[model samples]
Target chain A: MIASARSWVDIYLTEMRIAIQQQLQYRVANYFYMIGMIAEPVIYLVVWTTVAEQQGGAVGGLDSGELAAYYIVWTLVRNMNIVFTPFGWENRIREGTFSGELLRPMHPIHYDLGYFAGWKVVVILLWLPLAAVLSLLFHPTATITPLGVVTFAIAIWGAYLIRSLNQSSLGMVTFWTTRVGPVFDIYFTAELLLSGRLVPMSLMPDWVQQIAWLLPFQWTFGFPIEALVGGLSPEQLLGGLAMQALWIAIGAVVLRRMFSIAVRRYSAVGG
Target chain B: MRAISLFLTFLRVGALNELQYRANLAIQLLESGISVFTGLVVLALVFSQVPALNGWSQPELLAVLGVYTLVGGVIGMLIQPNMERLITDVRQGTLDYILTKPDDSQVLVSVREIRIWRVVDVILGFVIIGVALVQLQGTLGPLDAVAFVVALLLGSAMVYCFWLLLTTAAFWIVRMDEIVELFMGLYASGRWPVTIYPDWLRFGLTFLVPVAFAVTIPAEALTGRLTPELLAGAAAFALALLLVTRWFWRVGLRRYAGASA
Candidate 1:
């Protein structure tokens, strides 16, 4: 079993290297993508900072400094958790390349995860210095404790797993329908509101905050960042981590079933 | 007259093509509604704390949001679809068919593809603006109304020219769709008043991506905050960009044809 696990790791590392090389060839596109990744957070940061200032320095228990910290962390968490699969899934299925994925001994999700890991390494290498510069300009304040740091690290990986697996499931839905684009639009809208991508969930309407707690979206991006920014209690962190694990497990099961069904359909249809 | 007729014909074709999939209209409305709802929710969350944002009250900011949505819809409906089609056509060498057409190729390319369901955003935008205007009826004057219309028209024109210029770059860059995404990233900053941003960011939004002209100036006109000098500047910028993009489009076409030959 240990040897098998080592071989799987070896395969993923090789795939990661190849994916990194492929992504680097499109380095210009990567830079443009970097602009987009940073822009949305920066825009919201300015808006929230303005609000905090106008309200006499604090809104919803967060000062301008805290809001800055929240949004910057939000940016990093988003980069870590985002999956690019849903965007290209339709094209792949329609163009018949999905059959190639089906023919492989390994599941396609592993390849996607490897590619995602590679792409994020590139993004972090580019994004961190820029984030540091932004932190200097924005003056974000985070009360980073050892506990918060440890929880954040674990929660972030869980967030990545939850997001990637959930999106892979969504992408697999393209096997049956071409309307996955609209599905993504709806998903993004929900994430923007419920996941605290646009605002601190604590500042959201009470009902929304309640609903967000039950949903996986917050666990994927919001909870980790909010925890790191030092608002959540130990109980809350434990609950959030439990929820993330549950969602990740659910997502993996759902995606595995979806891949089996989709591949069967593909073969039946002579794909 | 011919150009208008051709545009109308293309619109009809697009509408008919989409009519086959009636479900898409519903989906489009749902997505657009969700985005609009999310925007309003964010605005409410911010305003729940503060009474005003940079001297603009919630109602005034609502008007700005309305302008942002309306402009975004128009771009998505008209400019973006056509530009995206042009990029794809350029890539697939299908642009040759557009060039061989009897009418002007530029006009054909600009009106080629339309997502008619985006009219929902345009209508929603108007409704929001109307509601906001009624709330602030006492403050607005006729000049403000006229300026709003003028700014909206000029803003749409500038955005079209800007997008066309970006699409024109497809002649040189194979993967220039990122340029459109870059445009959107900058344009997202237009969700707020431009003056509130830092000096450098403000300048970049104003001249680099022209988001100020496309969104903020129109909102400013409605709020009676638009200066005559700024209006003049926007008008001059629109006219200049129109001329420059037309010339640029011709250059791109020449390069495309030469390379193909």
Candidate 2:
């Protein structure tokens, strides 16, 4: 088991190095992509702060400083948690890209995971300076403690795990259908609404908040953001961490089962 | 005249190609419905706490959202799909076919493909605008109606020119679609009034990307906030950008022809 795990790690590093090299060729494209990533959280910050200001300096329990803090942290949490494998998986499967991946000893997810790892490194490198500039511009107020920071780190990592696994499972369904874009559209809408991408959960209706808590989208984005902005009670933090852990475990099992079935189908069909 | 004929012919062919997969229409309707619903919900959530945002009431903001949806639909249905195909064709050297054709290559590329199902967004936009107008009865005037039309037309022209100029960069750069995505990312700020953003961001939205002109300016017209100077500015900017993009496209074509030679 130890030897097998070591080999897998070696393969993942090799794949990540290759992916990073390929990504470097499209440096211009990546810079443009960052504009979208940075703009989304900024737009939300502007909208919410405007609402807050109109409501006499606080709305939904967040003053302008707190709102700014939440969205700025939100920028990092969002970038850390994004996984785009599902968007391309269907095409890869259809165009025989998966065939070469299948010939390898490792699971195909490892290949995508490596690519995502490299992508995250590249994006974070480009985005960190921008984040600093934004922080200076926004004057975000935070009660950031060391413990809170540690908890946030753990929660965001867990969030990435859950998100990646869930998205991979969604992609795995492409093995059966060609119409996965609509499914992703629905999922995107859910993320937009439930994940506090547009507004704070406190501002949303109670029922929407209830639904958000039930789903993993909020944990992937909102919980870590809120944690860093530092208004969460200890009990809430523990519950959120537990929920994220639960979702990660559930996602792993679900993804493993789906990949097994998908692989079986792919091989049976001569893929 | 020939350009119009070519555009219509491409529109028919594109419609037929999409008609082969009728299920997409239903899927698009579902997706558009969900987006429209989400927009309304977000508006409701915000307005629940406050009556107005930066002097624009909820109804006025809804009007803004309506214009945003409408313009976004037109871009998706007509502008974006064709521009994307143009970029791909350029990369693959399939653009030779269009160059050999008798009609203007720019017109042909600009109207090549249409995503028919995005009409759902257009219809949804109109319905939202209608509802908002009903709620805002008597608040809007005849001059406001004229101003909205003028702003919408100018805004659409500016947005189209901006996209064309960005995509025209494909002649020099291998991956120019990133710039297109950047424009789209900046365009999302149009979901709110441009007045709410910081001056720097507002300037970026207005002058750098033109999202303010495309969505918010029209909404401002409907809300009776359209200044004569701004409307004149929009007309001038739109016309100037149209000419600039045309010149840029010609430069790109020359570069392409030279590179191919």
Candidate 3:
């Protein structure tokens, strides 16, 4: 068990290093992708700010500056939400790549987890300048506390784990059907509405906020953004991390069960 | 005349090829339906907070969303598929095949591929517009209908030119997939009126990307917000962009080395 634990750390580090190198080489493409994503939050910021200005500088209890803060941090959280897509799984299974992956000593999910975690290092690095630019343009006011900051840092990684587990589980659906677009699209639509990706959940209707509370989506986007944008209190800040941990635990169990079943269906024809 | 024939021929072929996958139509319908649902939900969220968003009512914004869907559908069906192929052909040097064709390479490349199922969004867009027009207090006048059509055509032309110009850059920039991501992100901004955006972003959407022309202008025409000056300016800008794209395509072509080279 001790030896296996050591090996797992070694494997993860090696995989993450490889990912960092590979992602660095594709930095220009990554930057283009990041720039593209920036538009979403900026558009939201502009619209909400305009709305706030119209409604006596506040709407849904958030001022224009707070809205700016919410959306500016949104760019980072959105990047965190990026995962190995189900479409990728469809391609992997169809192209026979999954066969090669299955032959490896490790489970394929670990590969995605470690590699994307390293890519997150690159993503965060690339995000700084973009965030600076957004800060300059939008003037986001973050009263981020030390405790809040700590919670946010941990919650983001927890968010990453929960999302990766869920998405990989979803990706397993491709084993059954290649036409996963409809399924994936429905999931994305749900995530968009429930997650703070579209708008802060607080701004949503009371029932919508209640729905978001029950789901894992908010722990990924809303909680993380709210953490840094200084929305959560001390208890809520810590509570959000606990919620993320609960979701991660649930997600792992679900993914493990689904993967076990799904792998049986994978005939691995491409190899 | 030759270009028209070439476009129609390819359109038919593309439609027939895609027709075999009838399930995709359902998928496309669900996709567009989901999007329209979210669009309305966002509108509801906004309107629930305030009666109007910076002067535009909920129905007017729906008109914008309708036009956005229509223009997005047209681009997906016609422009994007071709432009994406152009990017791949550039990288692989397969553009030589299209270049050697007797027809103009630009016209040939522009019309070769169409995702016929994207018509789902076009029809859905018209439905939304119909619903919005019904909800709206004032009826759309005949003159406004003509103006809306004109603006929509010009807007589509501008979008086509914008796409062609971006695809043309593939000759210089080797990796171009991000261009699509970038376009989609910017194009999504058209869901709201350009007028509502900060001036810098509005300028970016209008001149940098021409999304303002694609969605907002047509919505404006329908909502009785179109000024003659604005429509005329859009016409001139579209013409100018077309000429610039044509010129840029030639310049980019000069850089193409083809596979044999």
The best candidate in terms of lDDT: 3
- Candidate 3 per-residue C-alpha lDDT over A57-152 given as tens digits, one digit per residue, 9 for 90 to 100: 988888988998999888988898888888889999888788889889988999889999999999999999998988898887768888888888
After superposition, candidate 1 runs with Cα above 4 Å error? A94-96, A145-154, A180-182, A231-242, A261-271, B1-5, B100-105, B139-142, B251-261
lDDT of 3 by residue, B1-261 (tens): 999999999999999999999999999989999999999888988888889998999989999999999999999999999999999999988888998888899999999999999999999999999989999978899999999999999999999999899888888887888889988988999999999988888898999899999999999999999999999999999999999999999999999998752
Using TM-score as the measure, the top candidate is 3
What lDDT does each candidate get? 0.84, 0.84, 0.90
Q: Model 3, stretches more than 4 Å misplaced?
A: none
Better of 1 and 2 by TM-score: 2
lDDT of 1 by residue, A1-271 (tens): 9999998998889877987887777766676766777888889888877777777888778898998899888777988887756867887777777777777888888888888888777777767877898888799987887778889988888988899998888888888875677778888788778888888877887998899988899998888997898567888888889999899999999999988887666632335
Residue A258, candidate 3: C-alpha displacement in angstroms: 0.8
Indicate the TM-score of model 1.
Answer: 0.90
User: What tens digits encode model 1's per-residue C-alpha lDDT throughout B1-261?
Assistant: 998999999999999998898887888888778878877887888777777888989888888889998999998898899998888888778798888879998899998799988988899888888888888775778888889889999999988888888889889777766777777887788788888887888888888778889889999988878998989989999999989998999999887843351
TM-scores of chain A, one for each prediction: 0.93, 0.91, 0.98
